[model samples]
Target: MSDFPSIPRLTSSKYFSSLLLLRNIWKGGDLSDDMQFQRVVNQRTYKGELILFAFDLCSVSDALNAVLMLRHVGFEHFLPLTDGAATCEALHALADVKALPTTPCFWSSSSNNHKGWDTWGAGAGCVSGERRRGYCKAEQLWAIRYHVAARLLASRVNLLHMDTDTVIFNDIYTRLKRKPISDYSLILLPESPVNGGLWYAQHTSLDSGAQWVIAEVARRTWEVISLRIRRRSSPPFDQAMLADALVSAMKGERHVAYMCEHPAVALQPPCANASQSRCAYRHYEWVVATLDARNATPLYRACFWRGDAIVTTDEHVIARKQRLVAVH
Candidate 1:
């Protein structure tokens, strides 16, 4: 028996159904419209690989800037996931004014009726304005993010999921493409000790072990959300949930590997050298690769001054992000 509380599968749960209802609301449940949306997603793919990210009205500016930076580095294909028609509309308008050639996939409730996200915290009357506005929290946003990623993976779409605050100096797609796909199911960047901000998920069939790994992570995500709703105390962040899920999988006898990819060296056992400054590990079909801190530093680190890809900014504040973009 599992110690974790029982939660329904994401695709079959009421929460998932509610999210779908919101997404279909804009099109009046038109099949053709859904087909067109799928076409748009496919059209944005570059050699079957695409970039995915989630944002809200609160973080739309950061999202737009992230898109611009991605394009500036020659990344064309992207799928920006967001909630609310206002946020989606604002994102498109910003993209148009900036000449960004990508479409955002809006899949959550609108400004007026946010019943869809009630279980995810919107029902608590959280108004979206800035990152720190109202009762809106990062965990709520992450709940939505993991759901979208799980849905995409279930549909066999390979993607590199990134946070909006990230700044890339090199062509990340080229670097990711070089990694052998058969070697791992997920490629993740380390944030402190847990994986967050940036990661890659490969397309996998419904019955594949890799898909099982994806489902496991999604399951943990829902569990985290459920706990947050039931308890008054703060719950673990999504990053912590991810870390726990991967660790559970490893303990369950799944194949996991760890390597330090920054120096372009061969895979070494966990902590092979006591003197090694940076190290990463992988799980079952999931691979955790660490980038040189100087190249992909997380927000908590002070190495962004000479970083190649700022994994993320400290907060969702737009002004600070804009300054970072200007400097880099």
Candidate 2:
């Protein structure tokens, strides 16, 4: 801990309290959103027991490529979204046969939210249809959905939000001495687009400071910006939001470290750590078909909810089996 400069902890501010009060009026009950958002900010102080991660279909072909990589590497304890039964079935079937480690966590927002709810209701009106289509109409929308999915999974499991394109270069569990389980309370990966994208947490305090800034920004911009800035033609919108949050969290901090090896320096992967030899995580650069398609390869598979396969219903046999048979 002494290796990094110390930083101030996040406490409930007057603005946070006012936001909570307004949230109560906007809805009812204990204001779960505020509470949860605060929980993320507050939980950052505690050590996380799990390494949670999330990703969405980059493309049918891109997704298929990722799934193929999953075949080589197994993820039995991570939570991911698969709203469609056909896709879920295919995923489970492949994992079951391959004996790939699979967890019981499967989340879908579409099925969870009740129909006929208010436009701004709990889950009914999450993202406006117009905003959804216009913001990044060219590219697919998957980042924010995973954000909600991360929070939902946080109810039971500590999350490690991973993009579909990312791959573990080493045995992260043994290297970090932390299982991908919910024990530390809260943890998150670091990101500063200006430097590079690195997914590794050396200490809980960084995550704490990082999350504080992100949650505050989220509350402030939820209504106005929806946390997605599209002023430029091309930029990682979600990453920008997260970067803003990280930048905000680092304010007036002494011990806090932000990806970079030295304090107050630009953000970069902390390869100096023993855990990360070269890079803890590697993100495959997004590529398109070129003159030589031979270099390109499919990595994962994902079925969109709008597709016909998503329309078909299928039973979860693996879940049933996991329930019936105890792995001793």
lDDT of 1 by residue, 1-328 (tens): 1111222222321112122222322211111245644664455555556677877777888887766655444454566766444557777777677664434545433221234335545453243542354546555556656665665565677767778876654334333444343344555542345555676666454534444554655565444334323324333456545544454343332222222221211122421342222222222112232212122212232222233332332322221221111101
Backbone clash pairs for candidate 1 read 255-284, 256-283, 256-284, 257-282, 258-281, 258-282
Best by TM-score: 1
Structural similarity to truth (TM-score) of each candidate: 0.57, 0.38
Task: Compose the digit string of candidate 2's lDDT tens values, residues 185-250.
Answer: 222321112211223222223224323333333332232222222232221244434433333232
For candidate 1, report its TM-score: 0.57
What's the lDDT for residue 158 in model 2? 31
lDDT of 1 at 257: 24
Tell me, by lDDT, which candidate is best: 1
310, model 2: CA deviation in Å?
47
